[model samples]
Target: MPPDPHADELRSPPEPFSSRRPTWDDVGRVADLLAAAERTRTGVVATRAEDVRVRWLMLDGLEDVVLVEEPGPEPVLVGVGEYSTELDLLDEATVVHVEGQVHPAATGRGIATHLLDLAETRARSAAAEEGAETAIVRTTVIDGDDRARAWFSTRGFVPVRHLLTMRLSLDEPPRPPTWPEGITTRRFRPGRDEVRAWTAHSAAFADVPTHFPLTLEEWVEDRILRDPAFDPSLTQLACDPDGEVVGLAFCRAGVEGAPEEGWVRDLGVVPAWRGRGLGMALLLDALGTFRTRGLTGAALDVDDVTIGPAVRLYERAGLRIVRRIDVVERLTSTG
Candidate 1:
């Protein structure tokens, strides 16, 4: 047989990368890697180092998180992944959330696959440890990313929910929020209003299918109190005549990628206050607050399946759908 010219090329292996459990010291670089990936994929940078720190704090430890890097004098992070599990006590199911991202330059090099494998392994172990009767693993991808959709589909995940990222520009004057009669608004008081706000949120979202009320401690620890970007002055609470919280607007000064824009982290009205247009008032109040802060825009994400009222209220307040994320899940175990 004649010598083949491409045999050497076929024999050569792909470039090598290293993966290890992430540590607190890696938080900033992980955030940078994630931000870079987001920018390459969506032209937006929303992963701040603080956000990454909060996420790591939520985990039991950093062992479940993996970071992939190109080995060199100054190693570059090319991929990252993590998995966490929550036991749905009411539903008797364990929900595992697997998240991962790879640098655009490293796509198709099997980095994502390796990360996903690690995430799933951690997920399964966590679910088993919780002794859940059923295990479901979930992940999310941008709505229009067909490659990502196909990747999850082949891995047995099916699209289950759609979340809309809505944005309202503050270039023009925003419509002033009109409070319902006898209802007044005030800024959140860090020490005094934390429990009250949590109670209000839990009541407001009680009917939401995907929402499981977090305990006051869990709620406070998640993002509101711990996030360095949380500005109490920017967070508004609508109270009835008796000084009870009826509605709330939780706003963050800025998100990781878009500091010029304010983030409406949460807006909700209790069921008793729902029909009085308090939801719209809270939303507008958030927008107004953002505008007053000199932010160029305001943004928030809503679950389309569960929060129809929120979507309509946001649209009425001039926020348009800027992006969509699809949540996909796989039922890994029936028992």
Candidate 2:
């Protein structure tokens, strides 16, 4: 049989390089490369060391699959890439999620192409080991990044979703918040509310695209119990008159690189509570909390505009789109 078309697209670009796996200690340097890449491409320093640490922990087969280019003493990390299948949140049974970044200055060196080749191969091997029958490969690029998008398109990846990163300046006072009748809000209850908060958030976003609800254990490990930045004070939740959790505006005090900004990581109102203005109230309340803490601004990512009236709610809250990211995927096998 001829070479697999899917595999053909992932062929590495002609380039000479060596690679190695990264350790937890490499988080700082990896973060530096990420910041450098983001600054060169978007004129902003967005990636943070903590984000890198969290992502590293989330990856499947970290040491086996992750690649660090030009590895050696005084080596420059021109590229980093990895594939993860453990968190396949899509409806599909098996998916190998590939993500990577190349130093902006190193773009033309075919580092990204080579990285994809490594990532896909490792991902396929991993899926087989896990007893998954076939798998899809998914990746994402900023919507404004034509070069990246074109490269992926030529490789047979098709755009499947769009996510927006929205921002709000705290320079102007946040509009005064109004709590809906029969509803009250409070900071997360550290010891007692971990499961409750997860349930509320997962239920609220259950129908949203790309939302794969995590098991309670996964939720605890990822955020609530162990994440260093788990500031109970900043993460807010809405409670019904009977004191049941009904909505949440989960906020992070700031990321490692940009500590002055606040992040509304997620804001959701459970289905039964939708259309009652709880989401808007929770959002404003979170902004108010961030403002009270003297944060410079706030940000969040919306999986898409049509997920609900979420876009409008965000707009009314003074958050504006700062970036658009596209999710692309290629079916590697159908069996």
Candidate 3:
């Protein structure tokens, strides 16, 4: 296909290394790039992909990052982006979440514009192959960080959602809760019967396409061993007296690249268990666990549109939205 002059201007003579599938060897390289980008003197924790998770697209490396040049050794890391994937129901949602920092040394060069062009082309190609017609992306800028926000607005993404990161001091008094009537909350130990529990947990998240699926064996064999942050004690589940796991609180602390940080992967209660305060119970339970671990702080991401009124629940439990992540979705015409 002949490239449009607009998109062509974004191209280099030709890419140095052709794109390919990522392997385990690429993990370290990707981590290195993230460290560099995140440590940009700006308080932004650039990004984090779990050590055990390298799926969707390995566009995490500098290879996926295009550097615009004009006869120089230190051309500049003008732009950085990732061609990642997530599931939208059964459809493959191809994504390109990018942020371009114009190199002060390379000002007046169309580096930022060119990088966007490159990203758009790559995103379009991937989306087309995956039967996606519409494009989607996201970017995060700190509060009062007008420069970055203005930059994205100029490129056509409206700030559709807002979020903040709320921190709870582990040193403070515990606000533990009494389990609701007939509901029993227990910490999940990856033991003999956990596979069945974990499998059912995966099924609960099946409606959320981006939430990766793991068999019980996969949970123990792959994730449990690969991630240093996987502490079974911090992870938890809530069940009815009937001996069925209906709600869960997935927790992890001391992420590999992110030190002194803890995350609430997710907290959910099955529809049948809704209104029983099960969600709050599971999360508050995790908080107590964190307090016990003598941890510093914890964070979690929540969709403002969640059906479970989760935003209010997290806020009530003292978790604040640290940052806002915009989710722009376009459905392909399967007709």
Candidate 4:
């Protein structure tokens, strides 16, 4: 029989690596891989095993994570992909945030592309499961990561937002916060303050881009009550003369990589209380609390859009932009 010219094309090519769902035992290795990739791309080692653990906990399960490795007796993790979904409070759209990382040594290969494809597939499936009328898939890269930006751009993603990580050195005492007239501050009470604090937070961030409202149960369980590092002394609430919560500062004593640096996880003032110095006061109080706790620095992330109020407020409180992450998204479905 004569050989057909297209026979070679019909044969499948061998895959270069193996992929599997990440297990809890893989947390440390996954963190190491992520840190290595970040260090190579951004010159920073910010990811820790604890961070990976927290993120995994937030996801439905480890099933949302995929790890690719070179096949061998000692397989090396060469790529990773993960996705999580949140429902937009206003429009009820499903926003799936996808993240992919390839080892620096594995660049120029198809590993990243494969991981991203898997992420998108997972996102679409999640959106379908949620019965979403609109599905958006989003990802982020460091501001200066042109290679990554180009990769995403080629894949139909467009830049949607920029987030800045601001840092403040607490080498000296922070200026005392002057209380706004008719406003007073107090420490956060875990059981007593959850509802009011959540209300204030939801109202304050309702206008912010990409902000989503969490149910009071979710707010208490996932954010404050379940967080092992939740320090009541570090968290504060601003109250009106009637003792209603109008603003809040939810802070963490230490984050994953920087033990001595406090993280201002969330700080906001309700719409009615804006421009009353309540936001600034809560920020200053957070910084003061961090300093009093022997923390050498404080950090927080805010939107970097033009003249953003949060950015301006943070800058006014002596926080300077240290890093920027560019968020990109693609509309996958308009069902």
Best by lDDT: 4
Q: In model 3, where is the ten-residue run with the lowest total lDDT? A: 13-22
- Poorest stretch of ten by lDDT in candidate 2: 3-12
TM-score (all chains, Cα) for each model: 0.74, 0.77, 0.66, 0.81
Error of 3 at 202 (Å): 6.7
Error of 2 at 254 (Å): 1.7
- Provide the overall lDDT of each model, using Cα atoms, as 2-decimal numbers: 0.79, 0.76, 0.58, 0.81
**Cα RMSD, model 4:** 7.0
The CA lDDT at 290 in model 4 is 91
lDDT of 3 by residue, 1-335 (tens): 34333334334523331222234544544554545544553556545556324332344433444334344463323333344434444344666565444444443455555555555665666677677676555445555456556666777767655554455555664588767798776677666547646755776676663466776777666556776667777778777788788887778986444556677876766667778777787877877777677677767766544624767787788876655544333232222
Question: Lowest-scoring 10 consecutive residues by lDDT in candidate 4?
Answer: 5-14
Strongest candidate by TM-score: 4
Candidate 2 lDDT over residue span 255-290, tens digit each: 544678898877888898888888888888888888
Q: Which of 3 and 4 is ahead in TM-score?
A: 4
For model 2 the TM-score comes to 0.77
User: How big is the positional error of residue 136 in model 2, measured in Å on the Cα after superposition?
Assistant: 2.5
